[model samples]
Target: METMRLSSSFTKYSSLSSYSSFSSSSSALLQTKSKNFISLKSVFPANSIPNGNRNLTIVSASKADDGPQQQQHSPFWGGESFFRSVLASMESVYLNKNPTAKAILERVHSVDNNQICYDHLAFRTFGVNGHGIGSMANFFLDFGYTQREELRFPEKKLKALWFSPPSLPVSDGGSGVNGPLPRIFISELLVDQMSPQAQEIIRKCTEISGSGNKHAALASALGSLTWEKPLYSEFQQLARESEYAAWTLVNGYAVNHVTISTHHLKSQLGNIKSVNQFIEESGFKLNSEGGVLKVSPDGMLLQSSTVADSVSFCFSDGITESVPCSYIEFAERLILPQFKNLPEKEVREFHRRDGFEVGSADKIFESTSKEQLTRRA
Candidate 1:
């Protein structure tokens, strides 16, 4: 929400025309002639999480009707210790791959306690119960996070949910810090929906994973992958049919990416555009699936991300090869026209758009797809 002044040079280079054009037929169908026109109603609902597959127990502190909600959630949902633990785990891997992020952290931490905070942490998981989306959600659900929105991508055969971390008033909510906290976006690959061959490859990976002690296999859901890696040939075959399944099977329960909230970071990095320019100039590649900048149809949310970093993946053949891991994202949210008069700080808290855009997210997912990876290779 903070205003950012762009230097003349960066401003000149940051035009929307500079980004690539999207070719997906779905995107073409959704595009409007006017730059500002976006179909919001079709893209995002007030707060709709698909009812059938979700088991949302965490309730927000702001909701007034505490009747049924009071009975459903845990009293020990979040605390400082648990919050730190999760960030520590994510930072370990994120920092290693993103030098720009690492430098930003160092630069900020040297001055005050205002180090970079994540806008969201994304995880890739299977559709199964204990070792799938449910398992990852349990970790946050137990800490007072409530599911906010469910996004379904039939084209990609993916279903994802975004959970809002608890607010301060929630007695057992996140980190004891009151304010905008990062969301947890967990997506599952609908393996059963894939072809028989793709399904079998994923099934084999999961079966091999579950063959161990039940507790251990369950633990691997959000932990480092424990199953033996699939052969590169198997990976390639699955990649041809469903990249989501192939990525999940290889990097089970891995953190897909860490997002940086531009609204929160504008005071430091100028804006999301500036952040993207800085990262690119610093030698990181931005995902060009949709474009370097993915603006919502309504233009409320603007997002861009670095392509996934190549990390070592040991295959069934016992050879370790570099494959996609994770990357950093920058998001700039605009104040809704209805609340444009509010103060910048207040606008961020009160009006900045929250929740993921299906179109933008669909393209964001390509950050790790075989197409992008193959291009990088």
Candidate 2:
């Protein structure tokens, strides 16, 4: 096995040839959260792993700042190693697809000493052929994430659910290093609700591609499209009916957006308003659908996002055109009314407003809409 070191406390080790071959023997590790190092182990049954040249990279985050530290933290459901690997892969692919987001993240890191923490990760899918939230939810649920609230966008013909991640160990004395993990927000378009023509187009593509649930967990991380590229005509027809459907057609399970937890920033850019201003001043266009700053009805959650970056895509017919890809979002979860009396230093993850707001999220989805794209153009 070969080991590769990544920035921060992450380390990657490659061994297996397929994600399916990766299984856990215990859930002990998922319950153990440490402030030091996390141990990772792989026990492959004889010949269970394929002989291919493919590499299954297992990544784990170590908390030691001095040098590489090794401590046993059981490996179950692939443990944190598998979880971190998935997150790292998604981020890598997302950054590669969105240059505007990449540059802004770099700037934010330079100012915050790379203390960046993700607020949540979003994904889009078709609510047909068993490829919706249920397919992706298992991957997180196996590793200690619990399903939260279900949000609906009736006007947009979409429904979504957000999952809360396992709480990290507070043994670090609330240093804010290994804070709460990012939540997962997954939304799916109601394919049956689309026009007959649009429905046929989607059904044809899904049938040709087959159900992608076999390894749906790795789809986003590997940046692989589960379905064949759609014809430009089909894409256009779907777009006329629902832009969300069109976007998901080409993007597949790839990340829709990764939000920056502005409150987690250790610098002056630690609020949504300041972060939005910073991004706009940095030459990136903000999604102006409902306004640059979207505040929750209760005013406890504030959010904003960059317009989706347009990337050149070659259609199934060999015609290529620029289409919206992914975007970056910024969010600030204000301290809950009950926790407002707590001292600043004592505030923790639970002290702030949690989950998501439908009204704010409804507008945030426009980050990839044509209206927002036209503003970018």
Best by lDDT: 2
In model 1, which regions exceed 4 Å deviation?
A: 1-78, 97-115, 169-180, 211-223, 266-268, 374-377
> How does model 2 fare in lDDT?
0.69
Worst 10-residue lDDT window for candidate 2 reads 40-49
Q: Residues 1-377, candidate 2: write the lDDT tens digits.
A: 11111111112222122565445434234455544222211100000112222211210111212121211212223455456656667777787888887788778876776346778889988877766766666676565555555667878888776666664443432211233467789888878788899889888877776756545667777888777888999889988988999999989888899888999888989888888888888888999988889887778888899999999999999999888899989989887665578789987655677667778888999999998899642
TM-score of each prediction? 0.72, 0.81
Superposed model 2: Cα runs more than 4 Å off = 1-21, 24-29, 32-77, 170-179
Question: Count of backbone clashes for each model?
Answer: 3, 0
Best by TM-score: 2
